[model samples]
Target: MQTRTHFTTRLAALVVAVAASALGCSAQADQTTDKIKSALVSRLGIDAGDIKGITKTPMAGLYEVNIGTQLLYSDANGDYVFNGDLIDAKNHRNLTQARMDELNKVDFASLPLANAVKVVKGNGSRKMVVFSDPNCPYCHQLESTLKSIDNVTVYTFLYPVLSPDSTAKAKQIWCSTDRAKAWESWMLDRKAPTAAGTCDTAAIDSNLALGQKMNVNGTPTVILADGTRLPGAVSGDRLEKALSSAH
Candidate 1:
């Protein structure tokens, strides 16, 4: 299953909701949004044949509108426009969550796995990837949890963003005797690796740049085999559960 996630919108849903009552009684939210769509077509002088689905959202003044593959919002009365988050102040709910949930999935999978060192357990029957920082407390917690799982292949990218010291520690791990064993040992036993003979190891810098490009701001961002990204530390049992249903 795709994980549900929400984006922070720029406007308040309360404003959209407040504008809903100002709409004509003959106009439903969808119809009102259509009117906005029709107006835009007339103004743009397009054929207006590409319009597909229109729906009313919980947003106060704006309508959550979809046209073919494009997504936008229009005022309840077809007066204004919107292109960002729709926040609900009363319930503290995000109206745009469902839309953004499927947005970043593809780019998540396109990440280069070769930059990450692989760690296999048991028969390697399953696969998951983790972005971790050597010195992050949460990453340590995730490392402990991944220990219990079996028959799984793990690709770990050392994110190393805690501080300057963490970068040094990560460089040592990347240049250690055994990339896999050294990582597991360092993470599980707090056994810091010895000084790397060469200080010019590229793995640390590579992972840092990769993390930045992938929007991995913190450690322990676990991406399942199916390309769905889950951000946070998860338990062993929970990890197993996720694997069971993941592709």
Candidate 2:
């Protein structure tokens, strides 16, 4: 009985030691993260709020710093920081870009579809969303590319950041009776919207805010059904592949 009691006491002590070690490690990690955040904020002149998260990477002593949709790598002490793709030569994978893609993903179901001009192509089986500007040449190019694609529903958010004229054109397009027609007519046919631009176009302002929040610095940003963001003009075939894989 005494031997059993001794063993039980030792086991309890060992468990306690293990738990204390775990707690100590967790506290140390938190401290390290805080130090890194502080160092980055001071060294890079980045807003503390903009530094979303700092996490240890697969590489020893390397940390992944997430700033909005962008990713940067740093040392454990944050003494060194670099912005570039971290490639795994053996696996032929880009870890940094993959993490950025993951971070930039939006919840498709949570989007405000009502704020967009809906255009249905063919049966409109697939879903896509676009942030476009009326004055952006790339947006016009993307509109042309979208014409060759079919069986997709595109929800266009008029994000007029280029100039005041772009905002006016977007307002006109939004106020028109047939928004999709007005947009396509202007984007594809080089014709301007004929609306007096006097309707409740609050959605355009909301879209501008949304775009800013999403870190959308440019027009012609394409979002697939699965919430993968494709910036700039994507080819029709690539878009088709993305659409097919999203399901």
Candidate 3:
């Protein structure tokens, strides 16, 4: 009986090996991906270009669809779609949100830093980018939080999307000879920016265009060193923790 069991196990292993050899793993995966892509375009009526790629998720039968920066999941057959977070049952972690963050990460060095008002504190070893509106109350709140943070460099891009008043205020701050000081003075002290000189305010315009291109729709959008887009006015401690973790 023992010998028969051993022979059966070896036979099963041999059969699996033969099957794997007949159809390579890479080729099998590619075939599945192609089928999903075809289903996305034909059955789902999603544009072929919009369907970036279909990849298997940690859950065996589920697959992730990369649609630009957003992530959506579908069944193995690509019939049903899931639009919510994929949670790990055992670990109690939001795996979908984590994957989305990874996919949506931007390149920190790719930003046009020259157009932004640079403020350095302490050793300035940590770096962060912020899209802020001068007239935004939340931006003012974020500014207050940023003031408490030490050993960091903040690149403030004047993103005036709130109102027309925001644009005027942004222009004034950007046109100032001492932009960094002017920005802090207004945000921290309630001191309005002085009248702008005839100096070229092209940088402000460039910043506006750049902000639009980056799809920054709101003020106080903070980007940490790891290219994580943290929207809204977060507390100083949270911001500091993120900076530390990235480092």
Best-fitting candidate, scored by TM-score = 2
lDDT of 2 by residue, 148-171 (tens): 998999999999999999999999
The top-ranked prediction according to lDDT is: 2
Q: Write the per-residue lDDT of candidate 3 for residues 39-139, one digit (tens) a residue.
A: 87798787888776789999988889887646888876778887888999899999988887776577998998998999999999999999999989999
RMSD of model 2 against the true structure: 2.1
> How many clashes does each candidate structure show, in the order listed?
6, 0, 0
Better of 1 and 3 by lDDT: 3
Instruction: Give me the runs in candidate 1 sitting further than 4 Å from their true place.
Output: 1-97, 106-109, 197-200
> Comparing 2 and 3 by lDDT, which wins?
2
- lDDT tens string, model 1, 72-104? 677665566666777778988776765544543
Cα displacement (Å) at residue 152, model 3: 1.6
Q: After superposition, how far is residue 136 of candidate 3 from its true place, in Å?
A: 2.7
Model 2: clashing residue pairs?
Answer: none
Please give the CA lDDT of all the candidate structures: 0.73, 0.92, 0.85
Residue 97, candidate 3: C-alpha displacement in angstroms: 1.6
For model 3 the local lDDT of residue 185 reads 96
